[model samples]
Target: MSHPPMRRPPIFPITEAQLVSLFMQSFAFGVHALVFAVCMHRWFCRFQIAGLGTKSWPWMVVATSLFILGGVDVSLNLYDNIIAFVFFKRPGGADLQFETISNWINIVRSVLYFLVAMLSDAALIYRCWIVYAHWKPRWAVIVLPTLLWLGAIVCATVDVYYVSTLHKLATIPHEKTLRPYLFATYLMSLLLNFLVTGLIVYRMRALSKQTSSFIRQQRWNRLKTVSRIFMESALMYTLSVVISAVMEMISNDAFYGTTDVSVELAGIAFDLIIIRLWTENTREESRTITESFIMEPPPARPRLNSLGHYQLRFPPPPSRVSFAHSERGSVHTNISKVRRI
Candidate 1:
């Protein structure tokens, strides 16, 4: 009798969702690289212009950390993808690999994301504090956001603990033990963003109103522009988090894509604020130099009168005063004074 034909081993196929996630991640990585390059260039330019004495060291540190972590996170992700798709000889394919929640790569990626979120939130909170530094009871203004940030830290810690302890075959989007903490972490971050953004916008509007009568129209416009930039950046970051949170809730593979994008978006958002402010400051300095050259009165010189005696000349009286707000929220008044002869 002829022997039964040998049965082929079953092949596990990757799903459309996984493919979509991979594509989106690749796209996001490319975009993130471009944005990161631009941001770094801007940051270096600012560093050169301002030197080491500026108060921007904290931001520089945060930006650098994000860049390094982002690179590592993406590198690990690519390695995981390669191992799963190219070299793995397992019966189950990439789908099983991607679904494994307790994988070391997955856990490390999650931790990197948590760190990014925390850094971004902390930077936003610091910005809020700087903006309200002049207010009475300044600490009171940031109390809520600070507490929420702490709560996020706790939730993330718990979630990571649970994730690390999961079984080898455990799947994501179905881990009940980790779900609540994950939800809480994202929710806390979302709420913190909203509250901080609102406080900052409110403070800016108040400053605008209080200075409306005395502040020049040009200065007022600049303040408004800064406020708008702050709002737009915050909104971009907030929307990214919102999308990622929604995807996570629905157990969509897009959550991986969006979450990765959000990590880069956080740095991008923070960098945008600094870039805009630095650009504006550069432009303002150039304009001021040009105006000084054009509008500066000639120096008073001693001249001989008809009486054959030297007479003293006096410069014109001061006509206007300008108020400039420093990065630290201090207001400076610049007044032109007549020279005494």
Candidate 2:
């Protein structure tokens, strides 16, 4: 008869660096979420109060909500540190069930990231509709929006595919060839974002050409506002790419935890930008309108006691005058004859 001994579990795989990153990521998310919420609230509430338009409000809300969801999603991932600290221990002391929860949290986070991307595309499309209302070049008005919608579909599909596949990879054994493609998919998304924004900028410029100076200026100002927001997103997108690319080159795991952080940072930054820019643009526009009203020339006062009829102010030159003398044969001769008689 022989006796068997139980085995002990391994130590946590996370390094001290990962722990620092997690804390930083959560802290950044908190700060970003606060700023974005403030900006979005101010913008949407302004429109709601103005009563002129509410269309942008709904889209803004949806977009901001996605960003909020994204922040929440990332924050949950940071919670993994706690789970690892608490539940993971020597063999038989901790349950594998928590690992399943962790995996699910990851899936949800990816989905939210995808949603945040989708909402950004949606917001851009809305902007295109606003700025490119007249950017009709044969069929752009129809085709542009269609392309935007299609881009959303494409982005969502790819993200879903990647997330689902990666999730399944954990359970089912598969060829390791698909790993790099996951990162490639991420690049495709960044490209989509960049393309959408560039198109908007081009169309804005084109649309500006067809408008009055004032409206054109307004649209250009809007362009700058939107561009700033897009730039924020762009910065995050680029950083995420760089980090992931470098991770790939060096075969490092730093990107695994940090990519999401990059995204969350970008989300918050963009959302705050959207809110602040929208609010500022609205105020600037309103001020422009108010100033126009204030500085408008007074209604030309009508001259009092004015002769309405058209009259020549000067007489014409006199023509040469000829008066002919007429002979007056009087009856004086008859009167003289009668007096003599």
Candidate 3:
């Protein structure tokens, strides 16, 4: 996916374009690998914080699955490197043609890449549902995203079926069959990110509007960090997918190879956000715990007795008698209100 096949590398000497493309692949893969490690570490920290009993278990699963997919991509890259070096770059290599570049592993790698994207998007949709849970007619807000998720799944299934059964190398199941799948997957993913982030912002805004006290306002201010992270991450990932799709569409004809790694950016986007979230969330939690401990109420002390014995003490001598008058000069004295004079 990183390399576009508009022009082939030289048989005698590699062209500047080839070098650049190679560099791009290496750089993109490096970024992908680095982010994958970060995501795993950060998600594991979150897992520890969330515990098995909480709602974070599913998130951990999704993150781990994405990490696994990254590993698979690395493995595929390793094989691709071996093939490219052995079969493509050799002085008297095999024909510089389709069989030389394409392989069945490409199918596996592409499908897995798409699978990770689907998983990431699915998690975002789940987040949207969680955010909008208080909305009446719950189905109204979720139905569209739910349907979109289903469409993505159907597209993925078709992609897997077509890609997995490929007989020719460097080939796909007709564009008509593949376009809908790729289009739906990427488009839905972007929409899901936007929708989820929007819902979260709405909730935050609602809370801000309802906040009355200074303390609550401070809490909302702290939460603004969380909201900022959500917005930036969602926009980042959505934009990455859009750029990747656009580059692919444009480069399919020209094969610039510079921005072909945008697919890898998708995974990188999630890792960065999740890491920031884990960091910010933990910081907020620790702050709350510290505040609670500091503001805790003091313990009540027991009353003391007097007269050199264990007798309850009464301080006042009851010098003033109390009276209640109901719209009359005549006083209505209450004995219960009078103290010992």
Candidate 4:
């Protein structure tokens, strides 16, 4: 008896893009959270067994904090999307269109995600410092990574200023004043990733060459593996950033959601350090086990028992024997007693 008036399509069909971003982000978050849990457990367990030292233990705390923060930020983003789809919109009026990408919630979420990246990048810089601190020219080696880290943070801060003040993201690239900062932020992040990753790889390989022990070489190799993983990860996220930025800059559409990949990968990179740490610690344990098997001492030679030494020859001074012979039978000799030996 009653029918609601039909509503026409809105100006934008970014709903599909929004949905794609939402579920992909959610899936990446869930997978990395699970990985973080597993890696955290293994990390602590291996640390306990393998002996947690001063230098690496503190970094472990930092890594955990970054992972936790990234998870929290992503959770907020998912909730923001849930609100957009489930609660914030009317069914018929202006609800036909997807939520705008530049909502305050999205802005806040993006800022937090960037904070996580900043923390991860800072950790990378710390690693570079520790690796090169003892070198001939220490501060000179540190200057580049330090600058990259600070530059990324500063650019992110400027970008955050814009994000906080605006409610729509599409206008960000066109705003002549803020556009350069936005581009610089992503560029700085990419640069920081490459710089720190290269430093780590170089330092670790150099360490491997300097150390004579097989175990130490293995340890360096493990650290180098972590650097490579993070580098690859950084490249992935950097590409996502590039694509999203390019698409938005050129297309004049509000449907570019590929930047979500960068958010997901940033979170994963933090937990990846833990995963690699666990691997390195377990490798040390395995090396110990192998060494034990190879370097065990030989068994001791026979010692004196209750009877006497078996090595020396013994001579009998006197002995008594009895011989018994039977018809059509073989003779047998039995020794009764020995007088001396």
Top candidate by TM-score: 1
Query: Per-residue CA lDDT of candidate 1, range 224-310, in tens?
Result: 777788899899989988898787687555677788778777877877777777676667668778977877677789999999999
State which candidate, 3 or 4, has the greater TM-score: 4
CA shift at 86, candidate 4, in angstroms?
3.8
lDDT of model 3 at position 75: 58
Candidate 1 worst ten-residue window by lDDT: 332-341
lDDT of 3 by residue, 137-223 (tens): 766877777777788778777766765564442323223445566667768766766776787677655544443232345555645
The 10-residue segment of model 2 with minimum total lDDT is 332-341
Ranking by lDDT: 1, 4, 3, 2
lDDT of 4 by residue, 200-303 (tens): 66765565454324334554465456556656755665677677667556543242355555666665766665566456556766886996676655545566
- Model 2 lDDT, residue 267, Cα: 64
lDDT for model 4 comes to: 0.59
Q: Which wins on TM-score, candidate 1 or candidate 3?
A: 1
RMSD of each: 7.2, 23.9, 13.6, 19.5
Which regions of candidate 3 deviate over 4 angstroms? 1-54, 88-102, 159-181, 212-215, 251-263, 296-341
Clashing pairs in 3: none
Residue 21, model 3: Cα distance from true site in angstroms: 6.3
Mind giving the per-residue lDDT tens digits that candidate 2 earns over 1-341? 78787654323323443465576677777777787768667665666655534545564566567666766766676675566567667553223423332266556765675666556556655554554443346355435555655665665566456545554422110213334554555555566556666765565444334332424365445545555566665566556656755654554445445665665665665566566565665676688689667765555444434567554343343343222331211222221111111
